[model samples]
Target: MKLYEYEAKEIASRYGIPVPRGKLARTPDEAYIVASELGSTVIKAQVLVGGRGLAGGVKIAQTPWEAREAAFKLLESSIRGVKVNIVLVEEKICVSRELYLSLTIDRAMRKPVFLVSEMGGVEIEDLARKYPGKVHRIHVDPEVGYSDYMSRIALSALNLPWSSLSELSSIMKSMYRIMVEYDAELVEFNPLAYSCEGKLIALDAKIIIDDNSLPRHPDLQELYGRELTSYEKKARELGFSYVELDGDIGVISNGAGLTMATMDSILFYGGKPANFLDIGGGASRERVREAVKLMLNHPRTRVLLVNIFGGITRCDEVALGIIEALKEVSQVKPIVVRMLGTNEEEGRRILLEQGISVFVEMDDAVKTAVNLTLK
Candidate 1:
């Protein structure tokens, strides 16, 4: 789940990170009161998305009245299709430099990677593309964890003084710890800057925790449910893309193109797909398991068809998820898997051992699943 900027900053402050004084306001009056206290505040729409500045979701207010006006204009607005019901009123910081720092899941390496850059803020994407060499990254092993020396080495590339390096390194350590502790897929401090007071402060922050790990951290739940159908909502909760259909066969794949093709093939083979689900790239066993369970327990689904051509995803992990769902779910349905890509042989072996057939051809799998649904 993606935490709003203010929510992410709240977590960061608890870890001893410096952030501008801010208050979350639900109304223009609340924003006015906050701005009166802070003086010269920045009003930002609290939406779970990026490019807020470009979308006019952000405004700099020189006075409390301006803050109120900005809040009144932004509240009840929409950014990238998401409604903004809250705003963050914060004291603007005067900084000498803009920098970027983050730790995120490295699926291919199966570890967390730290990214730091001199060019930061909203334009960081363009900067990185234009000058790729400025942005530096290091893959951190989960077992070894983060090391002070490693951070310092990476920091030196930016040509920083020893004092600055020590401070930034400490902050990086905290970020790394937060990512692991919170089961976060991404923890970021974009435009991590140095104020006039010589203190490094976070101007913006983002955190995305794994939805599958949500049960363990009930305290972090804040986002409300979307107005979607039962299966669509369930798919969102499971961190996958899904669309309900009036059919008897459930389709699962890793990408949109592949999923569309799977559904088309199902139709071609005379099978009506009950739903379209994409488990996403580099899906873990738990994620796959959740997807499988969703399909099997679905009332409209009579058969489950899984077609995975893994690139970042490991077929063994996919097989493990399928097996876990079959073992745990009470209702059993006809499941046919067409597995390929990394660890294919091992995945087939695992599925075969569980008395489940794994198909190598998509046509065969689709035909079999469609035929099974007729029974």
Candidate 2:
């Protein structure tokens, strides 16, 4: 789950990381009130996705009236097709220097990586590509978290003045500690600023908590009150949740590894995965229907792929779910299923009786799905 900048700043503030004072506003009038209270504020559109500034969703206003005007223009606008609903009015900070810092998991290395850069106001990816040398990354032990040596290394990489090094290092340590305690997958601070007086401040924050680890942090759940889609709400109610991705093929798999592999397989065969849908073990017909319906709602989805290597989940049960889902939706795209495990023969027989296409071989199923996607 991702926390908006306001929420992330709240969490970071509790740990002594200096962040700007801000308030969330749902209306232009509310934004005016907030700006009046804060004074010389920056009105930022609140959205889960990134690239808000480049999309003109961020505006600096000298007065409450200007802030209200900017909020009115931004509130109903779409940044890359996603509607903006909330705006954050924050006190604009004066900066003598800017830096980018983050603590995130490196799945490939199975460790947490600390990223530091001198160019902070812009997107990190752009800086990485244009000036790779300006960006410095270090992997740390997930169990131990960031140490003093790591903090010093990150601070040095920022190339800040020697006088401000201590404050910068302290802020980096605080960011790392928050990542460990909150079970955060990403804790990013952009334009970590150095004021004229040598004080450090966090200009913007982006945090993504580990959904799988939410059980341990009830406090986090309350802070992350971002709106959920109806389909996602239903899935969460049923003890599972999904987020739609941009691709042509929708996937349903038993586990995360298998789900990712299925997506990769689709890509390997010249097709992109529309979403990552993990039915998990012991999935029933109802769960299957929900997953399928969610996929069908995706505008980019052109094909469905059900790749199940049943361990505890029987192949016949998964097949029945697929059939039931087909009946529930008014219209659905082509489906290519690959079932191999317990009751594989029975599952294939049932699907064949319905005249549905089923592929026992993974290679053939992926190829067929790719072809269908192209069409």
Candidate 3:
């Protein structure tokens, strides 16, 4: 699950990463109080999604009254459609240079990789995309763990000042530690700035923890109760891995890898995925039913795509779940099923009996589902 900027910064501080002096405020009066203490503050809307600044969710305040005005404006607004009830009131930093640093799993290599960009900030993506040579990537072997040299080497190639090497390396190591300690999918420090005072500080923080690993971290569970979307909370309660998206096709698969592949297949076929729902290994008929019902209930899901390469999960069970879910939900969205592996024939027969055609080829099923969306 994605964390708010303040929460990510709090975790960074615990790891010895320097972050701006800040506090969360829910009211304009609280913002005024915090700004008075900190002076020259930045008021940022607390939202899970990105592009908050572009959405006018971030504002600078030179005075306490301005801080109150900034907080009032943000708290009354929505950032990328998510309501902002809280704002991070932080002391403004005068930066000499802005840098980007992040660590995330490189699925292709099955290892963790650190990405660094000298030309960082809001335009980092565009800079790296248009000029790939500006971004330096450092891959760390998961078994060996991270060392100081990994970041140092990447920074050296960017021609970063030698004086700041030690501090920047320390920050990078802390970021790696945070990712491992919290089972995070991503830990990012955008604008890991070198301040005018000759110190490094994280101006912005974003951490995405693996939702499946939340069970192991009870302390992080408290964030979910208030932070997660309604559909996300429901999916968690049902024990299915789910992520909401902005598209028309809702995807369901038995494994995380397959679920991702299904979404990719949809995209390749010119279809957008509305959500990712992994029923997980050995999914029961009830879980499948719940997954189907969940997708059908989503207003954005115009079509359902169920791709099952069943093993521990039987195909018959998947078919049974779909049938059961259809009975429970009144939403009449089109469902496309592609079943293979254990009990494949039985599953196909069950769906066929109900006048639903099952596809043997995943490509054909995906294509049919994409086509159905146009109708």
Candidate 4:
């Protein structure tokens, strides 16, 4: 669950982190109104993905007229395939320096890692590659998140003045605490700039929360779901990617890693995975049914693949779910099933009886699935 920049900034502001004043605009006229209110603002297209500046998603304007022009241009554009419909009109700060600060879950370590650098505004990966020494990282225990001691360590690592370090450190710790409390995967503030007047302001903010944990955070749920259309909210609520793609193979998987692998495998074997869909763990029959219906309805999906590596998930359950889903949809397209792990035999039997292709090996399944798609 990715929160738009404005949403993230609002959250940060609640934690006493300084963020530039901004307003979300749904229309060109609204954008003009916001620009007029902000007076000398930076117009930024709000999207879930990164590299917005590189994609011309961010632009500065000295007046409301220029701001409206930038808004019109960005709102009419697409960044990395995501249509820019919403724009953020924010106050442009006079900065003495740009810094980077972020708190993100380190999957490898199963803990949160705090990152900071003097060289900001540039991508963190680029900084790591070019000037590894400039970037500093420290891992925090999930149980004992952010503390004053930890904040001191981060501030010391950044080599800031003693007087300014306390306030900056507190803000950084608060951001990290928010990340943990909100079940955020990545909470980042890039070019966390220091104004000429000595105030730290977040110039760019991004927060990617774990969708699996949204149920626990009602506030965030309300905030994000507020603007989403009914269909978009329902799609996300079901834990699936309804990303429209120009491909023929609609993919469905149980895990994020598995979903990515399926997409790559399809491409490798000369088939295109229409979209990334993860039904999530322990998907009920109805949820599975909804997923199938959603994929089959996709105009670009000529074929479907339900590939499951049932460890905690049962193959028999997936099989039954797909059957139930098919019963609801009057017409179904070509589907390939590869069931492995728990209840594998029963699952394979049910699919085979339905005249569907089933495979035990991943490579074999992918190859056969791609062939079916090409047909």
Candidate 5:
């Protein structure tokens, strides 16, 4: 689960990290009010996705009028297909230098890694590729946890002034604590700026909590619930996983691994997936109906692709669900289905009877779905 920038900064502030004063506004008038209070502010669209600046979602407003104008333009637009419903009006900072710092779970090493870079405000991946020597990484031992020594090792690599080391180390330790306490998968402070006043402050914040840890933290779960899209909320209620994408093809699969593979195949064949919907194990006919209905409801979905590699989930049962769904839903969007394993022949027969084409090959099914979108 990802928290909005304002939400992440709020969490960071609670952990003794310095952040520019900010308030979230839902309307141009509210943005004006917040901007007036701050005098000079940065109007930022509050979206979960990145590259907001490049998307024209982030702007500088020197006055209330400018703030209102920025808010109007942002709130009326979409970033990466996500509607900007709220904007963060924050006090603009005077920066002397920008730095990057973050803590993230390293799956391969099975430990949390702390990353720092002298350069900031750019994509870390690009930074590492262009100036590999500037980016530093340290793997924190879970058993011993983050220590002042480890903090020194990470910060020293940045070659920051000795005078800034103490405070920067404190901030790094605080961020580590927040990551651990909140069960976060990532806590990033991009462009952690050194202000003209010689103070290090977090200029941008991002926090992603582990989805599996939500049950243990009701407060974080509530925060996440508020940010979920309608389809995502419904998917959770129906015991499935869904992620919206910018594309015309809606993909439904029985397992996460297969679902991802199907999406990749679609892209490889010059297609884009509209969403990722995993029906998971033991999906009932009702669940399948719900899934299909959900996919058809997406305005961007030009076609639907169902790929099932049944093991515990019987292929015939999946076929029945799809048939029932088509009978109930009003949309006439094309659907391509691929079913293999466990009563595959029976499933194919059932689908054939309903005038639905079923494919035994995954690539063929993906290709058909992609072709339908072109029509």
Candidate 6:
């Protein structure tokens, strides 16, 4: 589960990290009030997704009126489909330098890794790709924990001024402690700024807690549960994994691996997938119908692609589910299905009877779905 920037900053502050004074505002009036108190303020959209800055979700306001205007523009807008109902109005800082720092679990190494970079205020992926040498990584030994020596090594990589080293290292250690205490998968401070006053402050934050560990933290679970979209909440209730995407081709598959492959095939064939919906293995006809209904309900979905490679889930049952789904949903979108493996012939026959063409190969199915979108 991911926390909004404001929430992450609040948590980090509790852990002794220095962050700019900020207030959450749900209305333009509230923003004006906060900005008036803070003077020059940065009004930031409170969304759970990234690229918010690039999407015009972050704005600088030199006055309360400007802050109010910025908040008015952002409050009802959607950033990458996630509605921005609130904005974080923070005092704008004068930065002498920007740095990056983060702590995350490295699944490959099965240990927590600390990432530090002198380059900040931009996408870390792009930074790493463009200047891999600038970004430093340290794999922490869980048994040894994050010691002062590890902190020194991580700090040395940035080559920051001697004056900032102690504060930066302390912040890093505090972040590590937060990750451990909260069971966070990721805790990051991008643009960890060295202000004109020569103090290190976290200008931006992103925190993602492990979903499996949510049960251990009731407060975090509640916070994240409240952040879920209506569709996301419904998907969770249906026991399906669904993620919204920015495209018209809705995709459905029985397993995570196959679902990913189906989306990849669509992209490979010059198509974009609207969502990733995995119905999981051994889905019943009713579950499949629900999945189909869910896909059809998406406003951006112009076409649906159901790709099933049945093993425990029989192809014939999937076909029946699709047929049943078509009967139930209104304003049914165009559906292209690809079924292979168990009872494949019977499944194709059933779909054919319903005037639905079935593809034996994934590439062919994806190509057809993409073409239908052009029509």
**Model 5 CA lDDT for position 295:** 90
How many pairs collide in each candidate, listed in order?
0, 0, 0, 0, 0, 0
Point out where model 6 deviates above 4 Å: 62-66, 76-82, 161-165, 225-233, 267-272, 299-303, 332-334, 341-375
Ranking by TM-score: 5, 6, 2, 3, 4, 1
Those runs of model 4 whose alpha carbons end farther than 4 Å from true positions after fitting are 26-39, 108-110, 141-153, 156-159, 223-246, 252-265, 276-291, 306-332, 337-365
How do the residues 33-90 of candidate 3 rate in per-residue lDDT, one tens digit apiece?
A: 9999998999999988777778898899999999999999899988878889999999
User: Which pairs of residues clash in candidate 1, taking residues 3 or more apart in a chain or in different chains?
Assistant: none
Q: What's model 1's lDDT at 118?
A: 75
Write one digit per residue (lDDT tens) for candidate 5, span 95-168: 98888888998899999998889898887778889998888888888898878877677667766677877888
Q: What TM-score does each of the candidates earn? A: 0.66, 0.83, 0.79, 0.77, 0.87, 0.86
What are the runs in model 5 whose C-alpha is more than 4 Å off? 27-37, 63-77, 225-229, 246-249, 267-272, 296-303, 367-375
Model 5 residue 81 lDDT? 79
lDDT of 4: 0.82
List per-prediction Cα lDDT, in the order shown: 0.87, 0.83, 0.88, 0.82, 0.88, 0.89
Per-residue lDDT tens digits of candidate 4, residues 1-375?
A: 788888889999999899998898888788788888788899899987778889889999998888888988998999887789889899888998888889987789988888888888998889889999998888898787676777677667666667777788778788887887788898899989878988778998888898778889887666665444444566788766555456888888888898889889989999888887888777666777899888877777788888887776777788888888888786668888887777878887887888877888777888887898766
Candidate 1 matches the true fold with a TM-score of 0.66
lDDT value, candidate 5, whole model: 0.88
- What C-alpha lDDT, on a 0 to 100 scale, does residue 320 get in candidate 3? 98
Clashes of 6: 0
The local distance difference test score of model 2 is: 0.83
Residue 59 of model 4, lDDT score: 93
Model 3 scores a TM of 0.79
Model 5: which residue pairs collide?
Answer: none
